[model samples]
Target: MLSKVVRTIARPFDERFNLTNRLHESLLDKPVPDHARRYYFCFGGIAFFLFLTQAITGVLLTMYYVPSQDQAYSSVFYISNYVNYGWLLRSIHNWGAQLMVVFVMLHMLRVYITASYKHPREFNWVVGMLLLMTTMAFTLTGYLLPWDQKAYWGSTVTISLVEKVPFFGKSMANIIMGGDKLGQATLTRFFSAHIMVLPAGLVLFMAAHFWMVRKQGISGPL
Candidate 1:
């Protein structure tokens, strides 16, 4: 009965737009080689799964999070202590982010070891690198949102390192932190980047990466 209802609802769209064929081609018809079916080959999918997990939990965190230097710590405390299940959500988001970085590294290493980055797949390699960098940026920015002592000292050290980078380094660091110091401005900047800019960039790069993979298919064994 449930399946009948679904088909009935989908029938007009399927007939008018050829939805069934397109769905089959996109999802069901792709072929995978035997070697690429190995356990190690699953890293990229695991990384993507972690990314989805982080996104869902991150959105939930943002609902109760106050992104101010003054209230940030208090808000996080409230979430953990006052809001039901908020602690679990925040924990999952934090750990999922860390694991995403690990899996992305493993996926890139697998690609390099398999010689999958050569020739026509070079552009995809660049995209993967960008994705890695973006993930790092997400971690860095999110680190400061809690506005604790560790976050404070860590961001200060990072900004100091940024200032040491050759020409325009000091200026670039200022632009990112919004001043010479880590205060309310720095919190706002990091929070904005964490929730807004970095997510958009990640989505854009991920779409390109997936499209390329579908077009090129997975490369064969070494």
Candidate 2:
């Protein structure tokens, strides 16, 4: 009786979309390398999982976060102290960001050590490099959202380094800060990039990376 009900519900969609076969082909039938069963080779997947963790927790954080000079710190404080399980969520997000970076670096290292970025996989290597940069941007932007003294000064100090990049350095720094100095506009810009721009870029790069992997069939054992 239950099987009949499921079949009845699935039949139309199956006829229209062939969802069952597609899922079996894409998911169940996909071949994973034997090395991928090991922990070290699994760093990329771990980092990807952490990215999802950050996305979920970040969206929740955004619900109460204020992107303004005046209210940012207060909003974070409220979330930490007042909201139910907000502290736990924030903690997980924070740790997840840190671990994501660590795992991404480790993944890159494993790829490099295994020489998996050769020849046909070189473009995918470039994509992975971009992913690493995007991950760093995520961390840097989220750093200032708390609006604490440490976050403010850390961001200021870090952005200052961009001013050393030759002719366009100062200009780039101004654009990032949204002015000659950091203020409400800076916070808003960072928040926008954190929640929107970076995520979009990450998704695009990941899709391309996965496509290439599917096409190229992951590097052989070595």
Candidate 3:
């Protein structure tokens, strides 16, 4: 039985299609710079890991979440109070978001100070910027989903800040608020953007970012 299982696992690896070989060459064959052994050089990887953590925890939270204005707070309260490990999920999602933003910015700073965004790597910088923005949007949208006092006021303050953005300020604020005031529509829109729109943007930009990094290789040791 053991031999058969080994053969089954090994069979696909030995196929003529060269899939395993290609994957090994693309991933396992890559080398790390000696400098990457240091802690700060790990910022980018840490940021990506935090994003994955957020994605997982966010999805789990959504399963028990109620997006309606009337029940949004009650649902969150129930999860935190009643559901098994629900507080753990929310805690991970919340802190993971904060850490993700910090690490992404730290990674950006490391790249900047090291001049990693030069020459063949300039485009990856743009990809990173877009990813950073998407992460922040995820933060904002997720913040408002609970519809609690803090979340409500936080989003209101955010809209007020955007409302100061000159010509398009009021228009954007109105769109975000779902009307002249914050209401059920605001929660619904925020929940949609949180679980749907911004995540798609993150995935798209993250894929491009990783592809570019793999193609260009890591920046040289400084």
Whole-model lDDT per candidate = 0.93, 0.93, 0.89
Q: How much does each candidate deviate from the true structure in C-alpha RMSD?
A: 1.8, 2.6, 2.7
| 1-222 per-residue lDDT for model 1 (tens digits) | 999999999999999999989999888887788889898899999999999999899989999999987799999999999999988998999899999999999999999999999989999999999999999999999998889999999988988998999999999999988988888999998998998999999999999999999989899878
**Leading candidate by lDDT:** 2
lDDT per residue for candidate 3 within 82-181, as digits (tens), equals 9999989989988999999999999999999889999999999988889888988988888898888899898889889999998999999899988988
Candidate 1 all-Cα RMSD: 1.8
Q: Which ten residues in a row have the lowest lDDT in candidate 2?
A: 30-39
Clashing pairs in 3: none
Q: By descending lDDT, how would the candidates be arranged?
A: 2, 1, 3
Best by the TM-score measure: 1
Residue pairs whose backbone atoms clash in candidate 2: none
Candidate 2 structure quality by residue, lDDT tens digits, 1-222: 999999999999999999989989887898787866678888888999999999999999999998989899999999999999999999999999999999999999999998999998999999999999999999999999999999999999999999999999999999999999989899999999999999999999999998998898867776
Going through the candidates in order, what is the number of backbone clashes in each? 0, 0, 0
The model with the greater TM-score, 1 or 3, is: 1
